[model samples]
Target: MKIWGYLSALTVAILFGVWFSLDKTLLGYLHPIVLASATYLIASCFLFIINFSPLKKKILKIINSKSKVEDFITKKEYGILFLTAIFGSVIAPAIYLNGLNRITAVNAALLANVEILFIILIGVFFLKEHVKRKDIVGFVFLLIGAIFLSTNNLQNIHFDASLFGSILVIVSCFFWSMDTSLSKFLSHKSNIIYITALKCAIGGLILLLISISLGLSFSLPLDKLPLLLFIGLVCLSISLPLIYFAIRIIGSTRTGSIFALSSLFGAITAFLVLGEPLTVTQLSFGVLMIIGVYILYMGDNDQNV
Candidate 1:
């Protein structure tokens, strides 16, 4: 079961890596807020189908034996769920899309590694989740690898528009770290589908309102619809559910640390998807990140033992 948890985290890393890579191109077509709103709204609709589908009650019965049909989660848990929607689904995507607009896909993916550091801190200090020395050492390697990949032999470093964008991406990571910790706790108290659907719907609505208020263009290019649907279904819907499930089993620290590899996955995919050059230095950094994830996984296995 724990092995499955690790695999689920890996799957999330890959899917989100693809998303981060692909979204950079989408940003060229749509406003950041508009794209964020559309993706979340579409994902919410897909989740709604599942939430009220014919198989819903049966699936809920299998997954949530303790949950009453009417009210399984308390009010306090509901409040926390609302926070997850605000931070995770709403604010994080907004900031991330903004950053992705300013920077290249590879840079955005590399900077996303900061999310691991934030998650580890929250998981350790606030949540009182245990992490071994080995875990810290592994994350340190991940940090170094991300920096290396981002700088690319320390060439053309500038503190201008790109730097601000990187900062925005880091801020987005902080909110997401909060979301991961909160969602981990809530996953045990509520059904995963319910939690996911509510977050998506509420957050999507909030973003939609913001977009409308700002007079952002809501017109979806007919050509971009396929890409938007892919982001909605594969990345937002499937990826988020896997993330919540992994968090429930392995805890936020392990899951977030594993997600550091999204940078590596994104870098590899960029070669094929975006026609980005994959240099030897990038390849080396990717290898180091893989080792970091392996070290974290070993620490988790030791804890389970």
Candidate 2:
């Protein structure tokens, strides 16, 4: 991975951190599924508009000529795309939403850092990606920092010790991690804009139908539309594409390590915007996380991930 890859991952952390903080207000008023469905629908619509030209050209090319266009998507790619929708769009988010319902959004975001561990495992062992000594050392620092951040500087090393909700959040992280790893398979095989648009479309439609079938209302007051648009257009639409681009270039494991900063960013955002307190210990741990990421990429310019 180059600097852009790392930068993209870092941006995702910041975006999700801020989004989760803002999302707290909405979660207080709406069912998680209903909210997710609406935001995803908006994201899909926005992405489709961006993908429209290439989408039409590809369809026409396939029908009108035998020669492949640069952005042509294959059946195997579509299969992987659908799997990502299932894991990323539906299963992981649904489970995380339920877990988030039981705990604070900050805690839920912190718990999701466990996805880094799963990503590294799958990327290294399953995908056969290489690991350097510094990467391991940096990952150790990130992991420890994440632990400290979540546990309040070892005050709750057990991580909310006995909360089943916490466990649920971590479990959901694993599924999302799988989706992250699976996403790497799509990097060079298809045009991400179209693929991601379709992903959000499939996932959003499924979630919408499920929400309606469960008698959850899609209606929202005018006052709420602005925030909803921000969640969908910026958080969902923008963030998903950036993460995919980073993973495409950097590979999942390295991208995930940087993305783990979401926990620290979330805590700070909550403290600043939501009046949640940020203790000195958490700040210190957050510094360690920065150091970890810096060390993780110390020699990245020398070689690509």
- The candidate maximizing TM-score is 1
Q: What's model 1's overall lDDT?
A: 0.78
Backbone-clash count (model 2): 1
Backbone clash total, candidate 1: 0
Alpha-carbon runs more than 4 Å astray in model 2: 53-70, 130-162, 285-304
Query: What TM-score does prediction 1 earn?
Result: 0.88
What is the lDDT, from 0 to 100, of the residue 247 in candidate 2?
75
Q: Candidate 2 residues 158-193, lDDT tens each?
A: 545435566676777788888888887776544567
- Candidate 2: 10-residue stretch with minimal lDDT: 60-69
TM-score for each predicted model, relative to the true structure: 0.88, 0.81
Tens digit of per-residue lDDT, candidate 1, span 1-305 = 56767898999999989988888878878888888888888888898888888767786565455432334788888899899999988899999989888877777776777787787678678867678888778788777875665555555366667766877888898999899878766756445776787889989999999999999887767898898899898788887777776776676777887888888788767778998777786677667766776776673543421
- For model 1, the superposed segments whose C-alpha errors exceed 4 Å read 61-71, 130-132, 150-152, 301-305
Model 2, TM vs. native = 0.81
Instruction: Please state every model's RMSD to the true fold in angstroms.
Output: 2.9, 4.9
